[model samples]
Target: MVEPGPTTPTSPATPTDPATPTNPTNPTPAPVASPVATNGKLQVVGNQIQNQNGVAVQLKGMSLFWSQWGGAFYNASVVNSLADNWKVTVVRAAMGVEEGGYLTNPAAEKARVKTVVDAAIAKGIYVIIDWHDHNATQHTAQAKAFFTEMAQLYKNTPNVIFEIFNEPDYESWNEVRAYAVEIIGAIRGVGAPNLVVVGTPTWSQGVDAAASNPITQYPNVAYTLHFYAGTHGQWLRDRADAALSKGIALFVTEFGTCDASGNGNLKLDETGRWIDFMNSRKLSWANWSLHDKPETASALVPGASTTGNWPDSALTPSGAFIKQKLLQ
Candidate 1:
């Protein structure tokens, strides 16, 4: 997660003009809204996101992979379980990536995103529409189109957040920043005021890189870094601390309990320490998944009994963690 802080202005940079048409072939005029001040800060009802004094708001939550491409096994019960049982205040939804074979068709993909977004809104929880796999080659146009539509649809909804790109592994920070800036401009053009989340390099595990560049010029923009304990635990913690020291806001949008050395599958002991650190800092976080069926492909799913059946005792250790730490 990136830490929250003050935004500094960039050097006389002009925000991309919203009225300028990008696609003449699609002659539909872009959505419009009243002009608001652009001071590079997150605003709600014309006010910036302020810290609640020194008290840290516990933002424990989970992510949902509800689209068919991502193995659309999540049902309505899953959503209700998280909100009602886990008391999750946030939900990360993969916005149907283009490569996820299930969403190769654009129309179906849009419908899938709407399904998850609508469910999250009904629960009165903050939902993040993640542009998964935005780092894949030649996805700029797809990302722009997807974000533009989403911004136009949910611009006025404060509970909605936009993650412009999932994890940009191959691109340099400069390249990623340019792409993010372009997408942010497009969303702003659509009159959306939702907080936009930008990813750092190295699969969004580079919080130091994010801090060095800083998204101070974009209002309501938060630098996002994912942490997989199996790969980058210490670095994640150090980068998070550094971002906080710089007064920048961060969200631990993704993490798992695997060992940092990748020796085995899951390691709860190491993850517990990370969780404690996040809680101490008062940082916001979301677990990777909430799927309930072990027969399904998701790691978060509960296990099954004999005869290939999902038994009542199928909950994963991580799921139990959510029940204990986040739920109650």
Candidate 2:
């Protein structure tokens, strides 16, 4: 989880201008094929994410910045651009859980997430309802309530995926795994079989540790493996390989082309290597962010249109690189 500082912008005392869904007049080109329409419900079959037919699948997409600060991009127009222009198969709504987020103003924060989820569903793409909290173990009650409601609402929808925890900072795998069992129980208890992604310890880099002791009660569950190309190198990939050897499914829910600070010089070489690794392994992923904040991770330039139809001038170096990969 990003702290309220230079790397992660702080939110206002309260959200006075939350975003609502709107159909812009000049939208991007329409997407021809729907990933969800083709793949149907995704399942974990032997360390891989597969469609309903048991064929392996890889989903590449963008993750919206924290809902509290980057709420402008939570509308349907952004989702349309990602699906149509960016060629993304999935989108992640990282709803901030602290600061002036869900804990303080549940109604406003949740509305932003619902807008994204509903938009992704309408566009026939997969959506990850991420609980963007670092200290999720302390907020177990709130997390359970939020996911329980989400499961109940989208129980039958195959386009939804629940990320119970974004990144666990200092929590051990045992602590994180226990918290996941309860939240996964909450989601499964509602009869929602949508894929559930759980974060690992040490800012989601402890796949090796999670592999040592994995969750057994859940079906269609996978562990998150987050990385920033600049900070995490082959060492992390080796750890992931070891985890994969243990027969646990892995997903790159959040990644950056720059350092972990969310602002720094672009590491294109490392980013390329990471991309090649994910592609070779068929590991599904979502880019770190889709906002225009002044950071290496933010994809768009400042003052870029909140609506779709972004031209080349509107993209940052990181944005252009990520778009190029998604288009491929």
Candidate 3:
């Protein structure tokens, strides 16, 4: 749904060369190490994500909205502000891969991603390099190439988690699983030990289906479950519970405090219930975005500055509410 129209089917493009004036986007180099190393590298064990010391880790963070449209906010200063003030420890970079995105302008998209990734590296916080595609099954070749480059570029950085597919629409679990295995193999082939999270069917709400049969035999692999509290309710929770009962690790990479449409009123009641569930399970989660889009889910108001450190008046109702919760 992120893409208004379907992109033409095409193979994966070549990975960007890390060394060049046109180097891919990345964070600046700051001497201070963030939670990423201070706590330790993250790994998967059973249904939980473990820190370097093998302690269970739960990250409360924000996800930058679709990269193509929200690229303006993926800067080092924004990341620094979020980490230093917002109490966020993990950031997901939602790289747009379709519609006039990666396929149409690979260089621009890659640079945008590198900008965020490099900033995250400098900040020393964990980051998710998300292939923000709904029709990822149709772009397997491109995914392989992109992830390969990502793995090799940050093989030494365990903070990099690869989300090969954002939301898989209409694609069956069988199809999604196959694509994930292939992509996971590509990342592993590059000798990158970072974690890889695969999206489930039905816009990543089909966690139970993925749990029934998952992509095992790969280390640090997990599944994605997204929700918009105003729309997704008990039915979604039951599915997530089923996946957990089956020992499947789950990460809520993209979620909104509003309706699934990314607009309308905020559902505080349902949102609280979802938050309680995630808290009880110690599951990591990231809010929908850092964009200033004119919507209830958009945390910032129109005309808000692109740089981090916004005034309280610039926050929307949902932003104010979520920030309070994050501060807790």
lDDT of 1 by residue, 189-223 (tens): 97876878788887787767777776654676777
Query: Candidate 2 vs candidate 3: which has greater lDDT?
Result: 2
Clashing pairs in 2: none
Please give, for residues 1-328, the per-residue lDDT of candidate 3 as tens digits.
2332222122223223342222223523334656776665678898998888888888888998776677677677777778887878889988888766788888888887887777777677888999999889999999999999888788777667899999999999999999999999999997878888899999999999999998886889989999999889999999899899899899999888888888886898898899899988989999987778777787888767677898899898888877877889
The regions of model 3 sitting more than 4 angstroms off are 1-33
How many residue pairs clash in each candidate at the backbone level? Answer: 17, 0, 10
TM-score, cand. 2: 0.92
Can you tell me which runs of candidate 2 are displaced by over 4 Å? 1-32
Candidate 2, residue 108: the lDDT equals: 78
Q: In lDDT terms, how accurate is model 2? A: 0.87
lDDT (C-alpha, whole model) for all candidates: 0.59, 0.87, 0.81
Residue 323 lDDT in model 3?
82
